[model samples]
Target: MTTTATAGADAVVVGAGHNGLVAANLLADAGWDILVLEATQAPGGAVRSAEVTAPGYLSDLYSSFYPLGYASPVLRGLDLDRYGLTWTHAPDVLAHLLPDGRAAVVNRDVDTTAASLEAFAPGDGDRWRHAYADWREVAEPMLDTITTPFPPVRGGLTLLRRLRVSGALRLARRLVVPVRKLGDELFDGDGGPALLAGCALHTDLSPEEAGSGVYGWLLAMLGQQVGWPVPVGGSQKITDALVARLVARGGRIDYGARVDRVLTARGRAMGVRTVGGATWRARRAVLADIPAPALFLDLVGAAALPPRLVEDLAHFKWDGSTLKVDWALSAPVPWKNRAVAAAGTVHLGADLDGLTTYSAALARGEVPRDPFLLVGQMSVADPSHSPPGTESLWSYTHLPFRRHWRAEEIAGHVERMEEVLEEAAPGFRSLIVGRHVAGPADLEQGDPSLVGGAVGGGTAAAYQQLFLRPIPGLGRADTPVDRLFLASSSAHPGGGVHGAPGANAARAALARDRALTGELYAGVIGAAHRAVYR
Candidate 1:
């Protein structure tokens, strides 16, 4: 049953991305009158897919690969494959180009990856294997903890049981361990840190950052287990399928509607106001898939929010840096390191010293002399992202988002980016037919959710994670504003294309209801939040 009156709508969602769509779908299925307002003409903000350059070339607008989505039990429960979502995985998980004309490849076959590590450093194989095993033991449970709206109690206990006795004593220390130190401690040879460091750097994390080492190693294990698979038609298919299901379930999406504020009465959020002067009241709740800063500073307004919230908001650390350059190529990238060509994704940097230099420069708000680049070959992974016989390459290196681009700043950064590619893929630039560059500003234009070009919404650093995310002591999905909640990457389990934040938000809203809708949302959310938090 749908809402007989537009004014009787039970909830309003500010964005129609995967997370927003997931939240909307849950509400609609429960017989709530729901209206999802999307600022973009299209749905799926970062997950949007289109033929950006040429015909038959469907490029994912922003996010590309998603292991998080695959591992997610929340999105999986939706059975999106039936609605038009297919995944294609390469045999090799990834590869990183070393300064010394060699490459390290992480393969889905554990023995193969271990053997590769053994080739570089003999005893490292056993160590790597042990790490993978450890991850498999706690992977799903750990994911459940961060994603659920409530604190993950049982998941934490189960995970603690899996931890090595000694490992338990130093959980906090382990989280704070630098990536370099963690790699060096676990794997004794060159291949160890090189492979793990590259993985750690995947999400704008510096090797020296506390908790990054753990983040890197775990994702690498996940890759070896699942191979960072790209969807057959780009990441957008995930969103489209979810949206299609939502509409089929009697949901409605209103595009080109930009929300400017969340309306509240007596400290309880009840509706949202669009910039165009339209106010839609929510009978139950409102979900904002926007970043916390925008939600608090602009939408909610600092005056309305608590002082601690405003201060906490100011202290939020954003992993600053991203320079995306999408290229239309004549042929596939030819690599000097053969392994680089075979691997779906590549990480580029000269050495530990080189990466350290860039990290320091970035911290100081100055563009790095040499930026570490992450390159993705869209056509190689999924031809749908490019025309036939032609290729589309996605490459970007991090640089401090500061003023004073000085004449050669952008030019030098671009030169270094191309040079990094050329070093691994020797004939890369020569095959380029067209190019488009996106700095932080361009990314902001694409979606306000990607604040300051931080695609993860905010830094995925250890300090800002878990219950402390967005702010400390408020990870229950419910804001101080009562029915208002965050339903985007900015919320916990933090980042990636998975729909946990949206699911968590919807479950919280449905908790206020007790009918069939409440029962369904409760079960799905219960399977998560309770399995973890309670």
Candidate 2:
């Protein structure tokens, strides 16, 4: 590897994931010289793609859907279409299959989606429509609030103004309730509840978990507005577009430059030293797009962190691991419900009870016999992903983090997943032209940020969300270390393709550059810390 003795930049960003790229772009746009160092030869991290199964088939190795990506204020502000990024939406957004040959389909049209739920039961359509109408009123402000800095004073005030004090309190109560309980109270049929429950499965949370209702509600509402769109080519197009935009703005990225330590002086980050014996000096700030544990313990070193933070890091809980599989199919998936074929995504497993069992099994450190699968029919969503008449499809399931799966065990799990799919779509196995399976270990090997395959940065439990994310202190992007920022998904708002963490980090870094503003914001955050952690 080529190594430079020393380099200087206004800001040094560790890792070139989407978050890191966002930081680099924003800083560069501000006329600051930026340098992004990625450990891998290529950037994008988990948001990557390749022909894993067959030569002509394009498969997204990790993330595929972009409901959050589309709704993200930071991303929407960037005219990515000029940089060769286009979105493709399927005829339907998502479908959750049931054992009874019925499906709960989510469509871009609220009325149509409600109709699908109404078919399962009489009054569910009206209930869904009513809920969706309420969502529309507060959706924009809610997105702004969650995706903004901690405390969200401005966004919170806006929400309060929109809904009076009692209404705002009621909304908060609804957000904290478990999806299962909310579903039971709102809808009489299984279709609406099952659909919401399946959305909850995207996280490590079970339907019975309190904060899980928020994730389910958010994704479902975003689907109605954005339709779970994908890139026209593949997921890598997103990374490519970001890289292009960053480079155009005078940002520089060095591949295969793994940071070994964050250089500090007088309690402030100065620069970074790489494993390859090169140093990159940061004149302004250092932003880490890595996991929190790796940032504090490994790179910054435990000796540099506060004892209390070190303790918190030791006890930090991670979400469950993941098992992903991609297939190159000779024909489309033979779904029992043909309408499912028109959808971009599918959820398979048992009903709500089965989903609860799956979550319980993960918590118990045991693999579920019937794993819940999140399936992506890439070719169905974007035909350019594969050759004509063929399909490029992928699916992923959650597993217990403690389970150390061997090669044989991994194969067994893959077979079991195939069986589950076959049960839903008969003869699915016969259509497979080639296949690739990635267990939890493989996921980590591909991207260290996905520690133990915990994709959402860390467990997004009720106690670990919002103000308590990554730790129970102030949830701002600024760290205890001066001039150092945590710009990874491990920060507040956690994971997904949304660039909120990066944007928040950038704002913090920019604030620090202006001393008065930084001091004022710091005081506000300190007060919030006392209010929340006290």
Candidate 3:
């Protein structure tokens, strides 16, 4: 049915990203009449993947691999496997190629990884295992606790309670420390820190950036244990699977509908206004899966925003922009190391200085002459991606967030990117039969959620985490408006393909009806200030 003039649903979701879809599923599961308003022609925001270059070639427009996919219990509970979503794993040899023609093949077995570490620095591998074991104690619960919605006081306490009284104290100290310190404290040489820093860079957090240490080691270890794999078909499979489940439950999705404003009255969120002038009203709640700044500043209107919320918005720090290059290859990326060639996701930074210089230059508003690039040989990782014996590769580097990009600049950048790839693999540029470049503007045109093309919503830096995320004083998911809530990567636990933010928002909305169920979540976020920041 077409939405009537006075039409209303139990819940209204703005943006059809995976988080919004996850939230919509939870509402529909509870028998709520739900309406999902999408700005794009289809669902799946950053999680979207498409065939950008060739007939058989597929490109991940945004997010591709998922270590977060495996860690998200909320996603696990959704029983995605029953929905036809399957995951593949690469071998333990997750490789990091250096300019010296040497590479680190991280294996799943701790002993094997230990041996790899040992090669770089004697006894360093053993230290890595020791550090990993310590992380193991908190990894599960920390992943659970941090991803909790606004009121995770009990969840926070639960995590705190679970911490080894002694270990917790140590972790508490480490939590605020930078990744450089954490890596340096644990490793005897630069290899562990270099490789680990590369992983955290995946989220746009520089190694020098505080709070990134957690993400760096966390994902690195997770990838070692579970090789970063794409869904069987491509990243689109994950989004399609989620949308299929939502539609199966009678959910309504309006595509090609770009939202321009969030309608509110009496300090409460009521609905949204699209660029087409269509209005959607929700009696229960509004879940926004876009950036918080885009919500309060662009969509929600600055005047309607609470004063503190406005101040909080000012303090928000968006990470740098990104430059993505996709290729249709005639064959696989013939990595110098045979083992790394077989690995699913390869980190290709020549050395520590190369990584630092690239990131530092991005900070200084100049593209690094030799940018640190994350090279994904998609077809080689999964054979079904391209024509027989052909492959599709994705490599990206961070660029300063400013100005529109030109076609010539992007072309030159692609050429430079191929040169970088060829450093690890001898004849990489020759195989490119097709290619596409997405600059900041292209990303903006593609998905508005990538504000200034900062793909992870915003940087996943420690300062912008949990309580301080998006802005300080409002970390509980709930915005200044009564029923409006943020359900995007801008929220707690930051960015990942994980549906935690969406799940967290749905549970929060459900709390208004259930009351006590989500109180623990609210409490945790509330406690951060009650305990420390205040």
Best by TM-score: 2
lDDT of 3 at 29: 97
In candidate 2, what are the lDDT values of residues 356-383, reduced to their tens digit? 9999998898878888899999999999
Over 211-264, each residue of candidate 1 has an lDDT whose tens digit, in order, gives: 888777767877888888888878888888988888888788888889888888
**Per-residue lDDT tens digits of candidate 3, residues 1-534?**
243354778899998999999999998999989998898887899878888988889888887788878677788888887788988766653677777766766777888878877888898988888877877777777777766774467556766777747767877777666677777888887678777878877867666777778777778877766667678888888888898899899998988878888889987788888885678888888999988888889998878865666776787888888888888999888777775777777888557667777778777878678878887778766777888888888888888876477778767777787787887788877888988888878887888888777887776776787767777765666666666778998887678888888987787778754546445744554454344333
Per model, how many backbone clashes are there?
5, 0, 13
Model 3's TM-score against the true structure: 0.93
RMSD (Å) per prediction: 4.8, 2.0, 3.2
Residue 219 displacement in candidate 3 (angstroms): 0.5
List where candidate 3 sits over 4 angstroms from the true fold. 1-6, 514-534
Model 2, which residues run further than 4 Å from truth? 1-4, 519-534
Q: Report the poorest 10 consecutive residues by lDDT, candidate 2.
A: 525-534
Candidate with top lDDT is 2
What's the CA error at residue 182 for candidate 3, in Å?
Answer: 2.3
| Ranking 1 against 2 by lDDT, winner | 2
